[model samples]
Target: MNLKTYQAQTMAQALAAVRRELGKDAVILHTRTFRKGGFLGLGSKNVVEITATSGVNVLHPTEKRELLNPSSVRRNSHTQMERKISPMPPRSALEPSGPAGRDHSESISSTNRSVSSKDYLQQELKLVKQMVQELLQQNRKQQHPSVPEELFSAYMGLINQEVTRELANEVIEKVRSQLGPSQIMDDIKVRELVAETLTKMLPAAEPITLETTGKSKIIALVGPTGVGKTTTIAKLAANFKLRENKAVGLITIDTYRIAAVDQLRTYANIINVPLRVVLSPEELRQAIDSMPNMDLILIDTAGRSQNDDLKLHELKSFLHAAAPDEIHLVLSTTANQSVLLSTIKRFSSLNIDHIIFTKLDEAVGVGMLFGVMKKLNRAVSYITTGQNVPEDIEPGSVGRLARMIVHPQKGSEISDDNIPSIAAGEIL
Candidate 1:
């Protein structure tokens, strides 16, 4: 047997070193984490040290066959019993008390210790394999259970679409309750029933439009960084001003990034709308007052980090000042369910009632949107499918969203002709 020790800043690096030197058959003996490379531990980083061993003996197929034979097994068992019952040799008679004798005894002891360690490792390895197999079987049973043959495909489709297990179970339960057992076996009927149930469960708000509300509608867009808040705002501004001929105003509190301001300003300039850049809550109030004559004031806020409480609080202060008529929390449909939920929970402080899913065209699986809508129950206002301004944005209709969840490849069927130039009364 060969033993080696490796040290690295991370366990992954240490494991890489072990594999590089000992090949793939090495067994990890132990690991320890300690501080390294700092003065008096003030700035030290944690380091991982790994101890491993290799050179385990693996029996060949011919040797295993010979050992498994009945006659061979009997002979081997008898030999083992004889050796166990045999008397120990007298130390004095076996070797003289000298350096050579001491060296011989030490060598035999080392060999016995190595043999014992090898046997222990083999036993542990066998037990681990058994445990792993049992766990895999259990996991498979949990993930896929016995269901009617007709509905099995629909159930698998839901799981494959990235819907969470709990929500998928809910969908299945609803199908079971709504459809009779005879119809449950009809795959097409089962899928239709599931889609219909999901559609009702998903909440959708019509697009924000100026015709429904006589007063100036103050709409604020809030969300984390890089979720395309600026672009989505630009799309809304363009669609409202150019298509609907409504008096549009723009105010952005996103001074955190120069490019964001420049980007929004560029859109404002193209649409011939006034763009106000406010730094504090007081400035936001002044900006809102300045836009009183405008029919709709679209306010863009700084992209905040969901986990940064201070930033979110600062955002809350801005929202308090503006007191917008509607707050839309922009999100990406491509984000995983956990991240989407966390974003929603953190931003819930602002009393956000609307959601905007951006980058819909980039998502391979938008079924996560179903989980999000089910959890938050907040109506989604629009979904931005592409980068093209005004054209890519569409109202998040219930039927379209449901179809996207059930059949992702089919995508939203809401044609460009059907989407209103502006949100009807939904924004108000």
Candidate 2:
């Protein structure tokens, strides 16, 4: 048997070399790809290697003839039928203890080796095909021709910040479409255009506000476990009672956690506002009715896991009973986009009026927030930056959120006062 190995820049090239040297009858034993010729892996090029063998007929004469020509097999079908009928020999002749038996055993072993080699080749080809597909997908993502070179950095920035590629492309494409051939070359102009485009995509920020008819504004906060719902409730309560000097009432249905109830009670006492701890949906309604004179009533419910259907059902019952003027779903920015989206989808049945993003200061990037808001088309009412009551929380601003998505490094530096004003009519 003759065995040889060949290497080339591609599988096609490598196989061409194998066919030239080993002929068409050669059997492939193995194949692999590796990087070659690079300093510190900087300029490496992919090389394909193949191992093949020839000069060994692994197939029987009839099988080889059938494989080489299908039409011949149909023409010789009668001969094949005769051979199959006369295949059996006497037991002693088949099991002869001599050099003949040894040659028969050797032939079977060679056939087995050929079968094993064929299986190995098939498996390697499957893996190689999968790798090629993955490389093609990565290349398409990296070299998306629709995004120009000038906006490529901005596109990558959005991706690194955890924005979905689809959304990033949408924003970049919008920027490209708006900018002229000359403006695309200007880096600062491109950045500004990207920011402006992001700002336009955002829904208008609608913060909690009271009506002029002296009617009480009932607002409730709901979310999943450990998302700082209680703390956010305190911030909203304090801001209304202490800062705005409006009559504020605090109600907590968070009886599941004694600590959460106590925490809200502490804030109620500090802010010198009325506090109600309700157990059942009936009591929740009664609590809201009892605080009719208050200008703003902030209700904080116990955190329920999105996956817990029973708990979510109970939460919905409570919200239905309260029937608050606004239902703000409080979400933490620390959670990833998928989790955030899933939570929203689960809680969507509650008729979520707006979104309240908490833990903004702890988030690695606010881009996911932008993505969620854009995808859901939900408006943000408030954003909590830290743990400080009334101080860390602020009304949601589209300009501020857009700037953070565009310039993550300068997110911490952006403030309500410094956020560039976006025209209301420009909102998408």
TM-scores for all candidates: the values are 0.64, 0.65
Name the regions of candidate 2 deviating beyond 4 angstroms.
1-143, 418-428
Q: Residue-wise lDDT of candidate 2 within 1-428, one digit each (tens)?
A: 56688887766677678777866556554455677898998998877665666554444556644534534544554436222212122121112122222122233223323343344446657999999989976786677867776788888887888877888899999998998889988877887787788777878787886877999989899999899898888887777777777898989898987888888889889989999999999999999899879888888888889999999999989988998999999999999889999999999889888898999999866878888887668888888899998688876776777777677778778765643221122222
> Which candidate has the highest TM-score of all?
2
Model 1 residue 30 CA deviation (Å) reads: 58
lDDT of each: 0.72, 0.74
- Which lDDT value does model 1 have at 54? 66
lDDT of 1 by residue, 1-428 (tens): 57688887766677678777876665554455667787976998777665566654554454444433424433454334222111111121111122222123233322332343345446667999999989976775676664444566677678788877777777877788788878987767877787777777666565785645567999999998889888998888888888878889999999988998999998899888999999999999999898777889999988898999999999999999998889999998778888999999999898997889899888756777878877778888888988887678877765566556666556655343455545565421
